[model samples]
Structure formats: C-alpha cells, structure tokens
Target: MLLDRHRSLLFVVDVQQRLLPAMGGGEGCVARIGLLLEGARILDVPVMASEQYPKGLGPTVPPLRERLGNAPVFEKITFSCARDETIRTAVLGTGRRQLVLCGIEAHVCVLQTALDFAAEGLDVSVVADAVDSRRASSRELALARLRQAGVRVVDSEMVLFEWLERAGTDEFRAVSKLVR
Candidate 1:
C-alpha cells in the first residue's frame, strides 16, 4: 500500500556516531535519511528519533540531530525501538498506521524494530538505501527478510515523492528540491 503522509510517522532509529563508521554504505544511508528528514519537514509528517545508548554509541550524529528540531528524541538500550517503553508509547500516541523507517545496523536494530512494528499490525515501509549494517550481506539479508514478512521495501526518492502525492504545490516544490 502507498503511504499516506497524514497517516505516516517517520522513525529514525539509532544513527549514532561510534557505530556508523563500521557500517557499509553508512554515509550514503545517512544522506538518504537526511533527504527523508527534509521531505518530512516540508510535508508536516511527524518524526520520532532514537539513540540506542547515548553514553556508549554517542549522539544521533550531529547532522541528523540538528534536523530533528523539536521531534521527540528517545534514548534507549533496547535493540528494537518498539520494545522501548517511551518510544513505543510515543509511536502509538501518534495514531498513525504507516511507519517510514530509517537508521543503522539493519541486521540488528532496524530488523528487530521492523519485525516488531509489523507484528503490531503497523504498515511499515523501510527505506532500503537509508539503512545499512556493518556487513553489506547482513544488510541485504535483513531487508530481504523484512520484505518477506510483508513490509514495504522502498527507496528514499520513492518515499518523498509518495509523500508529496502530487506536483505543483509549495510542499511538493520544497520536497522536490531535497531529493534533487
């Protein structure tokens, strides 16, 4: 199903400092996520951010954190964001059924979170190019598994364009600039 902007929530899970360098294609993943953030801002989509463990992994990478604005930022030790009480509550409170996901360690955090969200009956759409693991194979496998479990596997531009839903409007104009 196509994501409805008004019914969608953006979840950026643990794109931290210490963990990123080890990830394959991590920089490009972060860049795509930045595009998602920019598009979300233009479309008025709600964003929820998480840092796995701030004391150890460091903050949510300065570039992304800066774009987060006043969106709720939850700190958690849980691998699956859905398993964290605060993050789970915030997500449920948004009342949105469609979740657009991005973040790190696709085999671990991203994988578990996507599975949990799916189990909860949320329509989860993961931006494939916006997430990666330390090993390229692990990332690919996790994405394959997620898709097998019924998640919408998509790319960054697909999401932004879908969220825009049309051309010629001010939101579309602003969002188009981000992906371009």
Candidate 2:
C-alpha cells in the first residue's frame, strides 16, 4: 500500500548512545534515520521518539536528539514501546494510521514494539536500513519474524519518496537532497 503522508507518523525507537557502539552498522543506521527525520520534517509528518531507560542506555544520541526539537520523547523500561502509557497515548493521539519505525536493537525493543503496534491494528512499517542489533543474525531473525507477523519492512528512501509522491516540486528537491 502507498503510505499517505497525512496518514503517517515516524516513531523513532531506542537509538540510545550506550547501545549503539555494540550494534552492527549502528552509525549507518543513525545516518539513515537522520535522513528520514529531515524528510519527515519537510513533509510535515509528525514524529515521536522513545528512549529506553535513559539512565542505563543513555539518551537518544546527539544527532537524533538535535533533530527531535520539541517533539515528544517518551522514556520507558518496557521492551514494547506500545505498552508504555505515554508513548501509546502520543501515538493514538496523532490519529495517523501508518507508523514508520526506526531505531536500534532490531531483535529486542524494535521487534517487540512493531509486533505490539501491529496487534493494536495500526499499519506498521519498520525502516530496514534504520534499524539494527548487536548481531547480524539476531537482526535477520527479528526481521523474518516481523514479516511473518504482517509488519511491512521498508527502507528510508522508499518512505521518503512515497511521502513526496513526485519530483520537480520544491519539497521534492529538498527531500531529494537528503538522499544525495
């Protein structure tokens, strides 16, 4: 299904500072998510972020935090962000049907959160290039399970272009520069 920008909101999962150095391709994942954030801003798609146990995991990394601005940031101990009251309320409050996901530890928090969102009847899509785990095998397994469970796995560019819908516009030119 084509993701409608009006129906979409970006959910940045626990891309924390302490966890990233051990995660495979974590830096690359951050870069990809940053691009998505910029595109989301240009498209006017609302964004919400979650930080898992910030005291232990640290904050949502410097780069992403800067982009977040005044966007709501939830702090939770739950593996499934959907279970966190603040996050659940914020997500439901948006009224956006399509939830585009990006963050760290694809096998754990990201995986559980996607499943919970799907079960809640929201259309869920995880940005494949913007998520990762400490081990590649774990990441692969999580993604395999995610597909089996009905969540759409997509890349950041696919989402950005879908949101843009066409080229030659001012917004397109701005968003296209992100990928380049």
Candidate 3:
C-alpha cells in the first residue's frame, strides 16, 4: 500500500546527534528523511519528529530541524515513539491511520514504534532508506522484523510518488523537482 495524503502522517523518529553516529548509514538516513520532509511540505502532509533523550543525543540534526520548522516535535525517553503518551496522543489526534515512518536505531525505537502502531491497527510503512542502526546487521535485522510484523517497507520516493498519485497536479510538479 502507499501513502494517501488524507490518511497518512510522516513520523520522523530519533535522528539525534549523539545517536546518528551509532546508526548505520546515518548521514544517508538524514538526507533521505530531509527529502521526505521537503516532499511532505509541498504535498501538505503533516509531519511529527521525535528526539529520544535529547539531553544526550541532542536535538534533531540542525538541517532537519530547520526543515521541520515548528511542526509537532516531541522529545521522549521512551524507546517506542508510540510509548510517549504525548506523541501517541498527538498521532491519535491527527486521526491519520497510514504512518510513514523513518528514523534511527532501527532495531529498537523505530522497530518498537512501528510494531506498536501496527498493533493499534494503523498501517505502518517504514522507509527502507531512511532507517538505520549502528550495525549493518542490526539494520537488516530490523527490516526483516518490521516486514515480518506486516509493516510495509518502502523508500522516500515511493512515498512522494504514492502521495502524488497522478502526474499533472501542481503538487506533482513541485515534488518531481526532488527527483530532478
């Protein structure tokens, strides 16, 4: 399944400073997620970013934070973004069932949150290129686990195009610039 503007939300989990270096391909994850955020903005999709233990990991990377603006951003100690009552409440408030998920430590926070969201019956799709762990094996393992749990694995472009749906709208033109 793909993201539908009306039914989905972009969930950017902990892409923190102290944490990113520990995440496999961390730089690439941030870059891909930044692109997703840019596309989401052009498409008018709501976005939520979370920083796990910011006191240590630091804030969401500067570039990403700059792109996010004042969108709903949450800081939590919980590994599962879903476990943070505020984040969960905020998500529930959006009433968006299709979740476009991406972030760091794929085997832990990202995995746990995706599973929890799925357990709540929400359709969770993890951006394959936007998630990572310190170890390549761990990232691969998390992807395997997420897939096993029925979370649809995809990439940032898949998300943009899926939300675009058709090619002629102004939204499509704006998003196409990303691929260009």
Candidate 4:
C-alpha cells in the first residue's frame, strides 16, 4: 500500500548519540533517516521519536533532534515502544495507524517495536537502510524476521516517493531535492 502522508506518522526510535556510533554504517543510516525526516516535513507528515533509556543512550542525536523541532519525543525503557504505556498512548493519540519507522539496533528495539505494532493490527513499515545494528548479521536477521512476520521492509526512497505519490508539484519538488 502506498504511504499517505496524512495517515502516516514517522517514528524515529533510539537514534541516540551513544547508540548511533555503535551501529555499523551508523553515519549512513543517519543520512538515510535525514532524508526521511526532510521528506516527511515537506509532505506535512506528523513525526514522533523515542529514546530508549536516554540517560544511558543519550538523547536523539543532534542532527535528528534539531529536525524533530516541536514533535513529541517519548522516553522508554521497553524494547518495544508499543509495550510502553506512555509511548503507546502518544502514538495512538496521533490517530495515525500507519507508522514509518527508522532507527538503531534493528534486532532489539526496532525489531521488537515493529513486531508489537504489527500484531496490534497497525500498518508498520521499517526503513531498512535507515535502521542499523552493531553487526550487519543482526540487522539482516531482524529485517528477515520483520518481513516474515508481515511488516513491510522498505527503503528511504520508496517512502519518500510513496508519500509524494506524484510529480510536478511543490511538495514533490521539495522532496525530490532531498533525494538528490
């Protein structure tokens, strides 16, 4: 299914300072997420973020935190954001059932969160290139698990274009530049 900007919420999970540097290709993952964030902003998609034990992991990385602006950032100790009452409430509060997710530690927080949300009957898509683990094997395994369990494993471009839906407009123009 195509991603509808109005019906979607971009959920960034644990792309924290200390956590990011530990992931393989961490910088590249963050760059891909940056594209998602820019596209989401241009398309007016609602955004929400989560920090897994921020006291330990540190807050969302500076680049992403700046882009988050006034968007809600939930702090949770649960591996699955869906398992955290406050985060779950805030996510449901947006009234958006489709979640576009990007973050670190794919086999842990990202994997668990996608599984939980998918089980709850929400449409969930995890941006593969925008999520990472300390090891490539773990990331791949998590992605395989996610797909087997019915969550869509997508790339950043797929999301941006899906959200854009068409060409020749201002939103498309703005988002397209991000891709380039």
Q: Give the number of the best model, judged by lDDT.
A: 2
Candidate 2: tens digits of C-alpha lDDT, residues 81-140: 999988998898889999999997899999999999999999999999999999999999
Residue clash pairs of candidate 1: none
lDDT for predicted candidate 2 compared with the true structure: 0.93
Stretches off by above 4 angstroms in model 2 are none
Which pairs clash in model 3? 24-133
lDDT of each structure?
0.91, 0.93, 0.90, 0.92
Query: TM-scores of all models?
Result: 0.98, 0.98, 0.97, 0.98
Give per-residue CA lDDT, model 3, range 91-146, as digits (tens).
Answer: 97898999989998889999999999899899999999999898999999999998
Ordered list by lDDT, greatest first: 2, 4, 1, 3
Model 1, stretches more than 4 Å misplaced? none
Per-residue error at 29 for model 2, in Å?
0.3
Deviation from native of the Cα of residue 144 in model 2, angstroms? 0.8
Which of the predicted structures, 2 or 4, would earn the higher lDDT when compared with the native? 2
lDDT of 1 by residue, 9-53 (tens): 999989999998889898899999998998898889999999988
lDDT at position 94, candidate 4: 88
Off by over 4 Å in 4: none
